[model samples]
Target: MQRLVLLMLFLFCFGSLHAQQTEPKKYLVYLSDKNNTPYTIQQPAQFLSEKAIARRQRQQISVTTRDLPVNPAYVQTIKGTGVEVWYTSRWFNAVVVRGTAEQLAQVNALSFVKNSRSLNRISSPSATNGTLAVKNSSGTSSEALNTMLAPGDYGLAYHQANMLGATELHDAGFHGEGMTIAVLDAGFPGVNTIPAFAHLYQNNQVIGTFDFVTRTENVYGANAHGTSVLSTMAAYLPGKMIGTAYKANYLLLRTEDAPTEHNIEEVNWLIAAEYADSAGADVINSSLGYTVFDAPSVSYSYEQMDGNTTIVARAADFAAATGILVVTSAGNDGNKTWKYISSPADADSVLTVGAVDSLGVVASFSSRGPTADGRIKPDVVALGANAYVLNSAGNLVKSNGTSFSGPIMAGFATTLWQANLSKTNYEIIQLIHRLGSKASAPDNTLGYGIPNYSRIVTGLPTLGAEEGVALVNPVTGNDLIILLADNWRIQLTELQIIDATGKLILKKMLQPDQERQTIDLQALALQKGVYLCRFISGNQIATIRFVKL
Candidate 1:
């Protein structure tokens, strides 16, 4: 009797659960034609639930910043469901829960909407244009191949190889030697056994790898996205493909779980980024985005792509401002309904990348962007078509996506930075933009176009010429005007006057009122023949030749 009663109650509950689930939950719509009637549900009641509607109107939205304070109302507006409706620096404005499918049909039937998707693995293949410095896959002793073969004079494969940034890095001598790059991705399978990557294993270039997903050091598993990304920077191409920074070090982070749906992956990414920063790394390249979540209620609308909307976005911005060069994939949803861009890519100050074919045209699937604040995105482009890549088993595979392009460009950037360690981050970015574009408008599809390394090497004008301080008069007590216009800036912190034989005549702090300052020289007792005036600045020192009579 007891067993029967339990069975009967279970059936009733199961039936009730089914009935409730089949009942119409709200349907989200994406308008195919954003130009006309951007909103599918115009009528207020049909567009939102009473509770949601009230929350939308009453909430305020604002970005997170310690230095920049936000308005209280804006913060209040963002506290509720309508908080997703705020705009980001990427120019994408998100909308909150508007209506159900039945209500949407009554409001306007001509819109596009679907349940958001869970995370998935995406990647681009390695470069395969011509012959790379082939390595012995046998894993025995070092073998040499005489006269490496460049790509044939004419072929699609050859052209594509030429389009890769590895070609640029090789010419610039930034083949990743003595530098470390950490790639935060999903998983890396069979990296330790691959013969093409055997060099890294033997040379200690594979410094360390961690799996943030499981909180373990084992990153080799079910995903190939990380394998492709890493090979682009470290794979040794004996005769087939060449990576950009073949000699550089690497760290792999597996943050995505392909078989699960949870927001914990984002938390994993943040922890990994902090780890990378603390590890004394010079660069961090991530090829992931967030615009969707597991639970229906937690899903993000278009308005939430704002720079400050998510936790990962804040971490990305912080990484860039801290002097670590960060590169991210723009995303792969060009023709899809959610064709805007993904989070972290939408973060301000990050080097967002787009995909381009061998012919220098934008890839059809490369995510397009004009951030919520109307800033142009995809700061650069790289080869991301059906590019050649190395698989976990040491075989060459062809893959396609913006994920591949990012690391290739990053390798080149890393190499260049290694060569010119003195350059500021902004200066390097501006130089690439000025040299890569066709001297016209930079668009969302291709931020500043692809960088041309040859031109950049020859065309980059030095920031300023070196100018030393000099005494204008050889006679006693002559006035001296220190001209610093030719130099970057010259507010000398300390000045020392010395005589010809290197004895200090007088030592004093010389304060410059401006870039060009005049100081009277009569006070110090000075002798003739080759006196030196030393000006000290932060991290920079200048000396001028002077004579006293």
Candidate 2:
């Protein structure tokens, strides 16, 4: 989805020159070092949670000075210059502050302050503001529902779940039983009040809330973008909707300002990611990205998307190093001029996701990329087109964007990790790449393509390829191209498309041709409606139903 890269935000008018110039400027004060910190790496518990420490131990990650909280003495000295210190980042060894020009001058002159980056948005309106919000999930125990619910209870959710092969994981009893996902977005406007999140509240699955944009504990206002994103993975209304990781605990963090595109948002995301790391999150779903910025604030160049350059990208890599698997959208500029994956998505450590329809056709707007440095971006694809998510009113709605797709894959990844708890974050990420569709023919359009969860546990592609109907149906293009499983093409095969009346619409006989075949639907002049596709290989047959939209 366009979680952080929508056009409306490009036209967003945060303030005029007079307002910006008159206001006290906010700055990201980079500290020279983390020397003489009160907390030691040996006793990380002073800053990091027990779970966080355990995760590091499990992954054989050695605690270092980077794991220590920012030096309190350094922060106090910066504040001595009269700038109000807003927040401190341990990883970056930096602090966010607001102050007058004179205050900034004094702080910059301090020997400990390496440099100060302006956090103020420029006057131009045609700059990046924030990622558009969408949904996936987080919640509590699935023990009750697992025992009481059936496959049909998932309703529309079943289709997308199957698309990600999450149903298989769910059925195997790994409903994110012991995982935590941190959702860093713009705001969670309706979460505290929305019915979709009521279950999470009742179960106390929502462990915490923080709005870095406001530096406040309240993340339940400002924008509803986060509400939709949370629902994709957290909502659990049986017979209506269900999240992929509905049983996983959640951390709602508002890191984007939503009204302006500024470098500070990247800093905000960095701090939130750090919070996720310290909070012991097993996964981080940041449906946020960055590219252009307003004037007076320099925008990122295409070359800067090399993953190691941007502040947020660096943080994403470090988060993964700390054992938190990060999942982020590949941006939604594919149809536009700035058509490349955004920062953090470019980071090598995170799983960058792109959007695709049920037909597995790349959504025209899902960003594309071989990263600026030529690394394959959007490490995978997921069903982002018309992804089923919950709105504030508890309505099961279709939301689109890499925004929704990122969470779909994020929650799925979390559940998969729950099933393979012994795997490190790096191993888990590598597993997805390995099981993804045809790693040998990986492309930037869909990265390695949709992940193959069946192979994750079974060590083989699901020969029951009928299950792919959800991912290959509701044809929208003029032609149909089917990618057959190896077994499907092992013998003479007969393929038939039948209308609802059981009348044969089209039939074809193949002499074990290669896996992919094209059927020109335009030539058939087929009407839009439900249809059944039947394929017969040897004595085995399978009939799969699909939709039009």
Q: lDDT (CA) for every model shown?
A: 0.58, 0.78
Candidate topping lDDT: 2
Task: Report how far residue 259 has shifted in candidate 2, in Å.
Answer: 1.7
Model 2: residues with Cα > 4 Å off, grouped in runs: 1-22, 122-143, 147-149, 457-549
What is the alpha-carbon RMSD of candidate 2 to the true structure?
Answer: 15.3
Q: What is the lDDT of residue 252 in candidate 1?
A: 71
Q: How accurate is candidate 1 locally (lDDT)?
A: 0.58
lDDT of model 1 at residue 243? 69
Over all chains combined, what TM-score does candidate 1 have? 0.60
Task: Report the C-alpha lDDT of model 2 over 438-506, residue by residue, as the tens digit.
Answer: 566789998988885655522222223553222255578766656677767778767776555444577
Question: Ten residues in a row with the worst lDDT in model 1?
Answer: 86-95
Q: Write the per-residue lDDT of candidate 1 for residues 168-277, one digit (tens) a residue.
A: 44533345555567788889998888766777777666666777554467788868788888877777756655666667777677777766544456655665665555
How accurate locally is residue 46 in candidate 2, as Cα lDDT from 0 to 100? 91
Error of 1 at 472 (Å): 20
